[model samples]
Target: MPELLTTSGNIALTPATFQHRLLEWYDRHGRKTLPWQQDKAPYRVWVSEIMLQQTQVATVIDYYRRFMARFPDVHALAAASQDEVLHLWTGLGYYARGRNLHKAAQILVERYGGEFPVHSLEAMTALPGIGRSTAGAIIAISTGQRGVILDGNVKRVLARLHAVAGWPGKPAVERELWRLAERYTPDERLDDYSQAIMDLGATLCKRGTPSCLFCPFEDVCLAHAQGEERRFPESKPRKVLPERQTIMLLLRNEEGRLLLEQRPGAGIWGGLWCFPQFDDREALSRWIDAKAPGAILEPAWNSFAHTFSHFRLHIVPQPARCKRTGHVSEVDTLWYDSARPANIGLAAPVKQLLNASRPFAAQPSF
Candidate 1:
């Protein structure tokens, strides 16, 4: 590891020195009032960690509060149905995280008596969604144990501090950062130290326009020294996201209830409720004709796009007022009432479409 000099250019900033300075800053500015921080229970910390993965703290607060209100502990979460758990998770983009979290809770309740295996990193990582860094955070934050985390925020902070080269997604680069994370993690005050590093990165060493002057490592940060604070922790190689188009069927019943289908358990928007989709207008028309012979198909609503990490989905919401012939299966299909929405998961785009359909809800009587 390269040595970093202090502001006077006279002394080296060792690991101990680094921890001390970070903790000092944390004592003043670190986020101590986050919903999860108030109660450092392993379950709470674990949920917060999962929610915060690839999600901003500001966006997670309300979701976390609602989730905790429903499922107060691992036992409660485990006992709840997947639909109920996922219902609370709607609007939180990553559905897989929500699924794995519920599964892990079940595993913990069944195998570990609903208690976290705080002493065992292996046990913690063995859980469905708990990776190494997340496990480290849970143990350290909940128990104040010696645990090191290399979350995105920490990765950015450390990458610039030593000016680490290469995209952090690379195995080599990630391994090096993990080593640095451990080297600097203090023995005492593990909870504060963990939060401090993450806070420093989020607040000061931001992805764009970092506040270099206010940073604790302002003078010692190698990237700052080179006037290339954003250069380190190289970005992943870019790729053109493929665009896929689909027609979303917004079939409404006489009672003004919208029809929704539970998506297959493993795909885009898995395990969530979504409007029936068709490849094109012809296919949509065919399904409508076969299912509801006298259903009135309205003009297609304005097209919109919902971009995912891998692809862009162009959605054309095809609204329809239909008379049902027989009872619809309740297993995978549902009649959703907007006023009394069931606790079921809906993707962001589906929710948007539902909201958009509100103004046009009073269809002409047949």
Candidate 2:
């Protein structure tokens, strides 16, 4: 394991000096042209903060612009339908953020007359998807209130600056980092300071090959001084991703409508439309034989492999043409107009498969 720098052999940081040095560095080189920095309105800040969670700033840039164009304000978000919100948030992996944003907007409209409650931390956290760090950031940036932010970028910056040991996810390390964050946050110019610190961490104090030469705190950064900046906040143990095999049945009617089912709202790819999936080939064959006895099973067109954070999905696509127009009792399915897949929430990979199969679906034979 790598070592962290110690202050007076104490191994902890001197918060006052650290804050002064970091703030000075921020004034000189921190990011200043981000979209969120242009405006400090509660809605703008809140939207950007939510979108930035577990997502890169570069990736969030265009998404933020389009999202703002659609919603414009909290009231607009609250009024939009769930489908509409999800549609705008497609390609953004975390669907829960969109749902929570919509929920919080509704709450804001109902409870606070469409205005964000900026006075208290408790009031802010009471809104959906706004945890401690998010609530703190909103209040700090929008209202100039002093608070701590502990996102991944800030965590990496602090861990390297102080050479804090142990995983940041652990409670003890998190508590120490929180204390450091609170200590460094200036009482005045709180919003600019907050954004500055985040920008510093993101731009110069990055995860890989950090540009320490341009960093404001390079002079005093313990990890940099110790020649082990990349080793701070020791990496966690890795786990093997389990693999799961499944079959996706593409059942189509004579009129070229493909069957898709809406997934239940609480699991992998929740609330998205996907083809009827089965765990085993035996079960799938039995389902097809019993449900559509006279249907013609076409050769498999393609296979899709998608990896989630926790597991890997092997989707085997089997196309079949059904003779009957009526619904099958066993399968929870519906035949959708193949051209208008946007009517439902289809996962990205499934959408790709549909698009790939468009030419085949348009032809007379499967």
User: Across residues 1-366, which tens digit of lDDT does each residue of candidate 2 receive?
Assistant: 124334323244466666666778778877778888788899999999999999999999998998888889989999988768877777777777887898999999999999988988899998989999999899988989886788888888888888899998789999999987877777877787788778877888888889998876776778888889889767776699898878888888878877787777667766667888899878888877877777777888656688888888887888889988674634546777757655456777767667656755553322
Q: Candidate 2: misplaced stretches above 4 Å?
A: 1-20, 289-293, 328-334, 341-343, 360-366
Predicted model with the maximum lDDT:
1
> How far is 80's C-alpha from truth in model 2 (Å)?
1.7
Return the lDDT, model 1, position 84.
95
Give the winner by TM-score.
1
Task: Summarize candidate 1's per-residue lDDT along 1-366 as a digit string, tens digits.
Answer: 244343333247689989989999999988899999998999999999999999999999999999999999999999999999999999998899999999999999999999999999999999999999999999899999998899999999999888889999999999999999998998999999999999998988899989998888887888887788879889999999999999999989888888899999888899999999999888987887776677889988878898999999988888989887344446799888888889889999898878777755653321
Prediction 2 TM-score vs. true: 0.88
For each candidate in turn, the TM-score is 0.94, 0.88
